[model samples]
Structures are given as C-alpha cells and as structure tokens.
Target: MNIEKRVAELVDEKIAEINRPDVFLVSAKLHSNGKLIILIDGDKGVGIDECVQISRYVGFKLEEEDVIKTAYNLEVSSPGIDTPLVQPRQYTKNIGRNLSIKMADGSKREGTLRDATEDAVIIEEKIKEKGKKAEIVESTIPLEQISETKVLISFK
Candidate 1:
C-alpha cells in the first residue's frame, strides 16, 4: 500500500475529470508525519481556485476509498518559482526564460532557454572574452546530462 503512489493516481483521476489539459501533477509525497503533499502545475500557471478544486476532489476520493486508514493532512499547491523544473512540459513552457542549470557532471550553466525538445534543450549562453565584447552562443544539452534546472528571476 504505497500511499504516495495511490495518492498520485487519485490526483491524476481528478485532473482527468476536471479536463484541464494544461494542469498537471508535479509530485505527490507522503511524509512520515502523516502529511501528504501534492504539487500541481500548468503550462501557463495554476490559480488558487484550481488548487482548491483539486484538493477538494482528491480529498473526497481519498476519504471515500479509505486509502489512508490513519489521520493525515492533505496539502495541494503549485511548486514555487524557486523549485527546479522536473517535467518536459515545464521546460517547454519556460522557453525564453533564463535558467541556471546544474549538470550531472558537477558543472553549472546559466543561459536563456531558447527551445526544448523531447531529448534536449537549446540555450543561448553568453560567452565573454577578457578583452572582447560578450558573444551569445547557442548550446544544446541532452536532458540526461542535466541534474537540476531552475528558472532565473530577472528584476528588469
């Protein structure tokens, strides 16, 4: 009885019932303290109303099925901006945004995400020579080589 996995399936069923193609599940985790956390996201974004709807629907289904015999707290929300991107759709939606990527080999890269594909991502990196002007170069990184990628926030 993998509670986390079961919760994820229930959330997916609710998402299908709601018919919001843009909205998708990011993660469903059940902590040792009886806390069930569900993270959802959308291609554009997710609103509080959508989170509420998912929470209500999933909570109802969980109660009806007696999935968790013990008392538990259910929390449903979107992953924060600081959270690293986990899904291909997340990367696709973030095209044109700057990203700070950490490679699996322990190197790091910062660039503007130009495009995202099933197997790789193209990013525009700024190359600077000590005495020369900065040059923009496009780099292609395979998805398997990336360990984590976070969207960079710009003030201007």
Candidate 2:
C-alpha cells in the first residue's frame, strides 16, 4: 500500500484513541544536512513534548524495531500554513478554506479551495492579470504532481 496512506491510517487511529479527530499527522524527514524537519500541523495544544510522547507511543504500536535502519528525530505539529498538498482527503477535511499549491512545472497558485477528491482540487480565485472579479477555477492535480501544500489562514 502507499506509505502515506498507511501513515495517515496510523495517525488517524492514534488520534481517535485520544479523541482528537482534529488531529493530523506531521512527520519529520532527515536530509543530508544533518537536520530534521517535521511536516506536521502544530496546533490544538500539541507541543514538542507532546510530539515526543506521541512518537514513542506510535513507535510502540508500530513495533518495527527490527527493520528501522537509521537514527531519526521526532516532531509533532499542525499542518500549519505551508505544508505539502498531499491526499485529497487532506483538502476535503479543510473545505471552504484557502491553500497554496505549487504545480509540477514550478508554477504556484493560491486561492480559496472549493473542494477536493482523491484525484483533484477545485478552487475559487480572482484572476490577478485582469479583473479582480472572483472566478472559480478547478484544476485536477494527481497526487504525484503536488510538490507542497499549505493552509491559507485568513486574518479576521
């Protein structure tokens, strides 16, 4: 199965156990720079300490002690304003909101999200080159094409 799907399932199950459906999973990746960066939604009172606790707890559940091959860091946080634009389920969970997307060809688009599916996302936006009038534009992006995604926060 897809690694991300499996991870999401694991995270969802764990969050459910804690009764935090609002909970989302963010993971950290180790790069050649010797730094660890986690892709998580840092919100809902979850802190670094809490992230460690959850990581240990999840690792206990995974029990993959025999296969894991390298030292890794753990970080738990919210999906924040700029995370990867991944599964459609992620978008649907945040419908009627705004997000920024980078296309496969290095194009960036930002607009209010209308909806999402496992395959595509529909957005409502205003064309910047011409009229400021709002327009609804739907672009279908395969999961493979997404480089990154971030939640758009509106300042009231």
Candidate 3:
C-alpha cells in the first residue's frame, strides 16, 4: 500500500483504540522525506494532550511494525481555524458562527450560519435596500453548490 494509505490505517486504528468518537481523522499524509502529518479534529475541540497521546500511540505502532527503519517524524494535530470545513459534522459544530462561502459558480456569500441539514445549510444574512429598513434573509445552500466554506473570525 502507499504510504499515505498505510498511515491513514494506523491513524484509524489508534483513534479507535482511544475510544473518542468525537475525535476524528481529517487527513493523513506521508511526505517523501519520511515525515508523517496527521490532522485530527473534534466536535468540541482537540487538546494538546490528545494530540500527544495519539502521536505516541501511532509512533509506537509504526516503530514496532518496522514501518520506518530510518529516522522519521510524526505530527498529530488539529486542523487550524483557518482551515476550510470539510465534513458535515464540522458544519454542524459551526452553527452560529460567521462563514464565507464560495459557490461553485464563483459567487461568494458571507453570512452567519443558522442551521445545517444533511444536504444543505441555512445562512442568515442582512440585506439593506434603498429607503427601506435592513432585514435578515436566510438562504439555504446545498452542500453541492458550495466550492469552499471558511469560518470567518471577527475581532469585534
């Protein structure tokens, strides 16, 4: 199997042993330089201790299996806030947060996430018209129509 696939399997095994269903594997990659990068996320959030425990578990498993004979590096961590949301569960957790979505047709929409269903998400946006009071409009966007969605962080 390819390195990436093998690493993914190892990650899955370790996560299963950890017994935290909320903690899930986002992505795993094995670099040509013998570096393994694993991204994990949780419904609430991933802590540094969780990352360290997973890293130790996977690292020990790999070493015992002789997966890497030479010096190798392993890193397990959460996908940062700047990372785009990929899973439906991820969207569900972000309800009430602002999101910037780029549609497949290249249009962009910024709104506060109101709700998420299996196939779509409801975003509430404020619209203002000339000589009219501003009102809130909710748009339901199918997940298929969105090319990318990123959580927007506001200082205020």
Candidate 4:
C-alpha cells in the first residue's frame, strides 16, 4: 500500500490499542521530503501528552514493521484553532462558539453555533436595519453547502 495510507492505518491501530475512544485521527500525510505529519483530534481537546504518545507509538510501529526503510520524521499533533472544521464531531464539540463559515456559493456567515448534527448546523446571528434595533436570527445550514468553517477566537 501507499505510505500515507499505511501511516494512517498504523495511527488507527495505535488509537485502538490505547483505547482512546475520545481521540480520532484527522489526517495522516507523508510529505515528499520524508516528513510524516499526523493530525489527531478529540471530543474535548487533545493534549501534548496525547500527541507525544501517539507519535511514539506510530514511530515505533513503523520502525518495527519496516514500513519506511528510509529516514523519516514523525509528528503527531492536534489541529490548531485556526484550522477549519472538517468533521461533524468537531462541530459538536464547538457548540456555543462563534464560527465563520464560507458557503459553496461564495457567501459568508459569522454567528454563534447553536447546534450541530450529521446533516446540518444551526447558528444564531443578529440582524440590524438602518433605523431599527438589532434582531436575533437563527439559520440552519446544510453541511453540503458549507465550503469551510473556522471557529472564531475572541480576544475580548
């Protein structure tokens, strides 16, 4: 099999062996320069210790199985806050947080995420007219219509 697929399988195996049901593999990529990047996420959040544990386990397994005969660097970590939401679980975990969404039709929306499911997400937003008080509005967006979604960080 291909190197990236093999690495992903090893990561899945390690997660199962360690019984980390909360943790899930986001992606595994073997770059051209022999860099193996593994991104993992959790229902809550992934810690540095979890990343180190997975990194070590996957690295050792790769060596033991001789998956990559040449020298390769292994890195395992959580997708950072700036990364876009790619999974339904990720959206569920970020309930009540602000999200900036880009639609497939080139529209954009920013609001507080109220609910999320397999099919769609509900967001609460505010609408203001020229001379009227702001009105609260909630919208349901289908998952298929969303091109990207990023959790908005407030420094306030």
Tens digits of per-residue lDDT for model 3 on 1-156? 466677778777877888887888788887788788888888888889779988998888788888776787898989888999887878998999999999999999999999998889999998789999989999999999999999999999
The per-model lDDT (C-alpha) reads 0.92, 0.60, 0.87, 0.90
Task: Sort by TM-score, best first.
Answer: 1, 4, 3, 2
TM-score of 4: 0.87
Model 2: how far residue 115 lies from native, Å: 0.7
Error of 2 at 10 (Å): 6.5
Candidate 2: regions farther than 4 A off: 1-53, 59-72, 128-144
Angstrom error of the Cα, residue 94, model 4: value is 0.5
Q: List the residue pairs that clash in candidate 4.
A: none
Q: Is candidate 1 or candidate 3 better by lDDT?
A: 1
**Runs in model 1 lying further than 4 Å from the true structure:** 129-133
> Which predicted model would earn the best lDDT?
1
- lDDT (10s digit) by residue, model 1, range 69-116: 889999999999999998888999999999999999999999999999
TM-score versus the correct structure, for each prediction: 0.91, 0.58, 0.82, 0.87
Index of the highest-TM-score prediction: 1
> Compared with the true structure, what per-residue lDDT tens digits does model 4 show for residues 1-156?
687888888888878888888999888888889888899999978899888888998888788889897888898999999999988889999999999999999999999999999989999988788999999899999999999999999999
Off by over 4 Å in 4: 128-133
Q: Whole-model lDDT for model 4 versus the true structure?
A: 0.90
lDDT of 4 at 147: 99
Q: Residue 4 of model 3: what lDDT? A: 67
lDDT of 3 at 65: 81
**Tens digits of per-residue lDDT for model 2, 10-111:** 566666777755556656444554333444442243556545656666555545632234454434454555556455557777777887877778988887
